[model samples]
Target: MEYMNIINQIIILFLIIIVGFIAGKNKIISQEANVTLSKILLNITLPFLIISAFNFDFSKNMLKTAVTILIISIFVHGTLSIVSLILYKKQEEGVRKVLRFITIFSNCGFIGYPVAGSIYGSEGIFYAAIYNVGFNIFVWTIGILIFQSGNVKGKGLLRKVFINPGIISVSIGMTLFVFSIKLPYVISETIKLIGNITIPLSMIIVGVSLCGTSLKSAFKEGVYYYASFFRLVLVPLVVYFILTLFKFKGIYLGIPLIVSAMPAAANTVTFAQIYNGDVSCATKITIVSTIFSAITLPLMVLLLK
Candidate 1:
């Protein structure tokens, strides 16, 4: 029964994605305006969602869980980094770089928060935020180097890692969580209301992004399936088994598993564009992996039961 609820939630989220697809096809969400919507989601709604997730009363166990999850998040990324590097080393330079980036990062924020919130409520979002702290840290640092070929340097690199929306929002949320500081009722409710916009808005953005790509071309490359298998299946399965072996269970095991199983980060396309990588290849892989995840993610959730 519980697993069925999870499946239902995933189906609903995907239905929203279909709406965005139709909207994109109908020109209801123009490509230019989709970019603006992405900005609003990243800079505004996402941060509020992070902050609002921290509104619960502080507890020692929760704090310990947060710290533990943060460590696991970093460890998972570090190991995946090494694994991805070796896995794709023989591919052409342009395709290799994008493959590594997509393999190492997942769409943990946009899809992660909403799914976590649905499953574990505020506590799920809280831990998802903690897990994402490691994502922001590595993504801006090592992730940038992958595409830039280590050209980015100095204080500029540090600023990008530390000053981005993800890190900043996590810092604010952590501060509130640690101090047990409560916003006034009005402010708290307002933040929650704004944060609620994140789920459908993000899924719609994904749908619109997908609508712009050619389904035939996106799936034509056999390499896209190979990479998606790693990103959506092998990585998460490895993480789940290893963590369960160590006695992690319930949300501790579940949240990380869900995040690991997410599609390639949407930022894969954005970074490929910014870095002059193979933008077409990146888009194809991202779209293909995301489409596959609609099947994989629900299966991942059912494993929790």
Candidate 2:
């Protein structure tokens, strides 16, 4: 039953991506329009989603679980960051940088929360919300730093890491959670309505991005396959088995498993473009890994059984 549910969820998400792909291919949405959509997603809708996820009735136990998940999240991402850095140490500058960034980050916000919430309800997104705290921190800091061929900008590093939209959302969400404060019904409902746009919009952006890429290149590169395999299969499997050994059951166990199984984040390409890394390689990595994750994610859920 759990397996079927996961399959259903992935199928639904894939269908949505196809919608975006078709829209992109047919020129229903122009590149400018797509960029605007991406901005709306990251800046507006995603923050609302974060806030709404924390809008539920609060409790001591919930707080504790959130903290526990945050700790585990840090551990998971930190471990992977080290592993990727070590493994990619000998590669060329550009490829090595892109590989490291994609390897450490996953689509935890766009894909992770939706799949997790599907299986585990709001509780899942609640945990996923906290899991993203670590994600936002590292992605903005270490993730960006990895791709920069030039000298590190130490001036605003602290500001950059702590002041992003992701971290800001997490902070507001945590404040709401910690204070047991609830927004007015009208306001909260409005936030929820906007927040609901996040998943589809994010997936559409991904699909649109994919429409311009050469799937052939994504497959032709042997390195792409190795990186995708490490990302979509091996890393998640390692996280799962290790967590199981410690007997961390329930959402504590499941959240990490779901997150670890997510594909390379769509922003790998975005960050690469911004930081002037290997944008083509980043796009290839993002697209190919996402395509493969549809298969690996379900298998990972089955293994959880």
Candidate 3:
């Protein structure tokens, strides 16, 4: 009964995506509009979510565990991304960039947060948020560097990311926490008010973005499917065994496993656009991976539990 309940919860999220898929098929949401929503999520809402995360309670054990897990996972994600790119060396610049993004990035914030929370509750999200801090920074700086190696100026790299509202919000939120600054009851409430819009808005926007894209195009590419296979199954399974070996077990172990297994992020699309990577290919992979994750995620979560 408990296991079936878990599967049912996952189905609810998948159904949300399917609804978006149908809406897109009917021309209810334009790609342009979807992108606009993504910008709002990226620029305004996502940062707020990060800030709220800092305000949550964290034990020393949680902090230490998160730091260790992330350090290992970061290298894994980066290496896989590079390897995937190398495998496709003969492909055009755009297609290579898209695959590289798929390899390196996981949907920790946008998709991972909601699913993790539903499965493991608030504790899961808090740990996932800590993991997000590292992932977001890497995506902005290192990932962008990979994407824009030939075209960008070194002097303005940090500025390009820092000036954005999401990064700024994360900085402010973390700074407040570092100083032991407690947001007054009223003000913290206000930040929470503004921050709450992020998750659903992000999903809806993803739905909107995914509305009209062709899944068939993505399936036609064997390389993209291979990447999905590793992401949705192989990598998480490896992480599971590693966790068991280390004697770090239970919900903490299970949560990060799912977070690790998430599909490619939408931010990858932005990276692809800026760096001359393959936008169509990136979009295709994101669409297909997300769809498959609907099934893969529940199966993994249940087994891990």
Candidate 4:
């Protein structure tokens, strides 16, 4: 039953992607417009989404769980970074960079919150939000370095890493969570309403990205299948087993497992465009892994149950 709900949500998201793909194919969303959309998503909607995730009422037990999740999230990302670095070292440089980035970062924000909420409700979102802190931190720091390697040096790279929207929003969200600061009802709702655009908008952008690339070409790259396997199958299985070894079960185990299993971050395409990485490769990996997740996610849920 819960697995059906997960499938339904994914199908809805995929439908939105189809909408964007059709629009892009018809030239409704031009290349220039897609670039602008990416900027809007990264700077505007994503930040609000991050902030709104922290809007729930505070409790000591929740706070404790939040802290635990934060620590685990950081450790998981760090481990994945090392693993990706070692695994993809022999690939071509451009593809290597994007592969490492996508493998290390999943679609935690755009897909994770809703899916987590569906299964665990508000409590699930809280864990997703907390886990995202580590995600934001690593993505800004190490993830940027992956894209910018040898291109931007020293202070330029540092500026990009430290001053991005991801870090800023994480900072704001974490401050609110730690201090238990509540926005007035209207302000919170407004933030959430805007933040809600992120998922659909992200999917549309991904669809737009897929416009020119054929399904054959998209799957032509064998490396994409390798990356998808790492992202959708291996990562979640490793996370689930590791957490269980530590006796972390229920929501703690489930939330991280789901988040880790998510497809390549949609931001892979956005960031590739921003940093002049391999945009086509990014799109292919993201879409392929996402399509494959329809099978893997339900399997993960069944395992969780």
- The digit string of per-residue lDDT tens for model 4 on 110-131 reads 6776677667765676678778
Misplaced by over 4 Å in model 3 are 89-93, 149-151, 160-170, 175-180
Top of the candidates by lDDT: 1
Candidate order by decreasing TM-score = 1, 2, 4, 3
Per model, state how many residue pairs clash: 0, 0, 3, 0
The C-alpha lDDT values of all candidates are 0.91, 0.84, 0.72, 0.82
Q: Estimate the TM-score of every prediction.
A: 0.98, 0.95, 0.85, 0.87
Please give, for residues 129-244, the per-residue lDDT of candidate 2 as tens digits: 88988888788778877876445677677788788888888899889888888888999999999989888887787778778788887889888889999999998889888988
For residues 191-269, could you state the per-residue lDDT of candidate 1 as single tens digits?
9999889999999999999988898999888899999999999999999999999999987899899999999998998
Can you give the lDDT of residue 177 in candidate 1? 83
Residue 67 lDDT, candidate 2, scale 0-100? 89
Residue lDDT tens for model 3, 1-305: 27777788677767776676666677787777777777777776667666776775545665576677667656556656556656567777767667766767788878887777667665566567666656766677678766776466766766764566555765676566656678889878776776678766767766766755676776788887787887788878877877777786776577668887899876777777777777788788888888788878887887665
Quality of model 2 by C-alpha lDDT: 0.84
Which model scores highest in TM-score?
Answer: 1
Local error of candidate 3 at 192, Å? 2.7
- Candidate 1: residue 176 Cα off by (Å): 1.3
